[model samples]
Target: MAIVEVIVPQLGEGLQEVRVTRFLKQPGDRVERDEHIYEMETDKANVEVESPYAGVIVEWLAKEGDILPIGAPIARMEVEGVVEAASPVSHAPQSAPTPSAPAAPPREPVGVGARLELIIPPRTRAYARQKGISEEELRRIPAASGNKLMPEDIDAYLAGRSETAATAEYVDYPLPQQQRAFIYRIKRSSQLVVPAVLRRPARWDAVRRVVEQFKSTPNAPVHPSEFQVFAYCAAQATLQHPKFRSQLVGEDTLRQYPHVNLGIAVARPGDELVTALVKNASALDFVSFVRTLQSQIRKARAGEDQADASIQLLLTYMGGYQMVDAIPVLVAPAVAILFAGEAFPVEGVPHVNLVLTFDHRLINGVGGAEFLNAVAQNLENAETLVQSGMAG
Candidate 1:
């Protein structure tokens, strides 16, 4: 019998090793050509490896949680016509069929060459099932292939089919453990590269008024909220100060985006975080801007937002959690992050604290301070300025 060796495949550039996250097939299990065999974790994402030949598993060289380099042999399988293991003797007669029992449906053939597959964690899968969404339908999502499908892609598919019967039964799924590992890596990288500067008090009187006005006017096209107003103010401030709206491309070079693309940080029910981008925040008026922001936030909360844009800056507000201050890590490629905390009564006046974190490599202490000051100034006079802009 011929023995075929299964080797770890190359994932991507800069990826040299990967951790075996899971093994779908076990030793002695029959596997068909192109059948998914194992999952590997990389720094950026998780990948699945497919079997190269049809065979019976003879040995497993790798174990779960073990790290292996690319091109290393992971397993060995004995090809067809092999009699390595003895077949069990059956006691029952070999009858073609019983009239009362129907034949089971055929299993779908597994594809070859490392096709993508969404790896929903147990929690996410349970949640989805609780919401009555069929797992089969989710598996049919166009982008739900490869080592693992992203939560955002699943969300987008559900949102697009919201009118359909299955959409109403949609429930969020937790990210797989491997995806969490990816997030941890990102967080660690951010912490290493981005430094916390200062946490200053942010005036939110104008922002409150805008939110109240939108809440009061149910018929208004846009429902303004603190988050939307904050985004608007930040966008306007970035437009006024181009430096705050620029990205650090290299040590000496900064790329200033033509239009303000403000990224709003939305934390999912899980520990994961997804940012929804408001493209061209400078062009839209208050109502239009608010409407767009609301849509994007909804999409983000539902796990539908993906694709990073030319984001000049990021704004994360955890005011509802009563967080008084925070030193937010900057999303790479972007130079700055603005974290706003809960509004509180200070000296009998309502106020919120704004913490600005920046990449020291790109902007100096004075530059970061200046940017925060500009944002604070805009927030302080937000009401009058926004009203005037809307009127004009």
Candidate 2:
């Protein structure tokens, strides 16, 4: 039997790291070739990874909640080939070491008098070390929320220290893996590309009327919302506005997708942001569209899937909140994003603000404004859109 190393494969373009969420197969469990063995969470999606070898799992190099770089060895599998290699677990940076008795608590240092007990979690300690925070400095940092010193406390202390620094020197702290990935995309999509935003108001009365009618329907498939109506209309709008489904490639090229893969922003526990992607959203009938969108959103909330590059546009609905308007970020490979805010009475007419942020490299301000107008028109005709969708 050959002991083969199973590494974390590249899940997406420019994806450097992922956090292991769960393992479908434990050590010693048998697995088939191409069988899904584990699940991981990226910056914007949770995805299952398939094992390449048909083998018995020998050991796991990474544990649940561990964030590992791509191509890092995750497991050792005994396979049917003669491929021979030494066990990488001995020195693998991300390996899961054998379980042992918990280490003794760290004793408070001598000479320095600390006002409170030093209670630091393992993750927080690691974060402090990465920040070049000395043990003495950590001991002096105050914990605002609880007895335990959290990462946030370190951030707060650092912020205050920077503000009162004696010199102009700067300190760097490593960003969380998820945040780093998000920034990477933003840098590529927004900072590198020219992004333009346009705002317009749409009447929400029609949306409310249609939503109320749907709610009154006995045995309704799903309770409709203003966001749903807007999403359906936006998806339809993409058909008429091809540029909305296109993405800039090189300096002088654009790649237009055949279908509208709409991304809906979802906030998971801890306010972790993810996207619920609806593939070919423009093709589904309104009822099917609603069901599919709801299912995808549930999966995103549960961390079951991540948004990929195929998604051409994104929709962030702030209608449930008191927000009146927001400028949404345009993630890379997606040419545009739409933001909808809460409706308020304008001269006794209830209207919601819509902001469309688009990549100027592919869409001009005039085109962006026209697209926003199309979405607004769709919103104003919510009953017709809902009826057409229900008919399908």
Candidate 3:
């Protein structure tokens, strides 16, 4: 039998190395060509590395959480003559969950300066090192988690400790492929994106009347979702202020998109967030907008990649939430985002708070306020939006 080396394949441009997350086959198990042998994670995405030949695995060269550069040998396999394809790359982050092994016994509290060796991602270890945090301190932090310690848990512990909370528990979740991209965008926004926020209370009386009128009317326009109403309003508002459809790409220049791709961030079951695109939303009228929104939901539930990274604008709502409004993160490249809180009736008037956040690097505070006010104005005149059929 000829022994061959199975090497880590190039995942994508600029991705030099990845952390081995799991191994699917043992050393003795035979693997089929194109079958997933192991999974690896980059800083921004997770990926599954597949075997290129049908062979019995001789030995594994990498372990979970071990970082390996591209082209490095990952495993050894015994194969016959004329080996097939030796390398294949999957750029998308795919699942390769490692089965959990027996947990180590909980260590008894040692002295203040005791050292503890824990198994975690390199990023977590680096963060702890950068902060001069010790394993003893990590042990003190409480987590409503599994056996493994993650970077997010460490970050949460630091945040709670800052507030001096004695007994703190943080939820550690398995990073879903879709959620990772969202988290990456959020963190990127918080890093360098200078954001300006504006909040205004919009009366939803006109909107509810509009929805009720449509539902009651025979052969009327397809009744729209409250989120759809907000989307249409946000879209129309962009027509008045084109900055919402623009991206900041230069020191003094803003690149405007030809179409307004309105991003809708919907929270799915399991607390997972997925973004769906309403392409050319401003161009579509009430009836078309509702149809497009429904299609977005259908595509999302079908496991399609709903989050369009190139979405020109974003709109989100907390319809059943108790809050008045929220300051949304201004995702980089995109100039602005909108968030609407749950509507509450006050003195027979339905009111909901609307918030607009813009990247201050491109749009000023005054511009952001005007855009938000315009969105509110469109919603307040909900009758004007849904009045026309075939508005697109």
Give the clashing residue pairs of candidate 3, or none.
Answer: 46-93
Among the numbered candidates, top lDDT falls to: 2
lDDT of 1 by residue, 163-206 (tens): 56455566455444334434544553464455658667878887
Candidates 1 and 2 compared by TM-score, better number: 2
For all candidates in order, the CA lDDT equals 0.68, 0.77, 0.71
Using lDDT as the yardstick, the better of models 2 and 3 is 2
Better by TM-score, candidate 3 or 1: 3
- Off-target runs (Cα >4 Å) in candidate 2 are 1-181
Deviation (Å) of 49 in candidate 2: 15
Backbone Cα, N, C clashes tallied per candidate: 8, 2, 1
- Model 2 gets an lDDT of 0.77
Residue 62 local lDDT, model 1:
52
Better of 2 and 3 by TM-score: 2
TM-score of each: 0.57, 0.61, 0.59
CA shift of 88, model 2, Å: 16
Tens-digit lDDT track for model 3 on 84-123? 3444464558666567856568655432112222334446
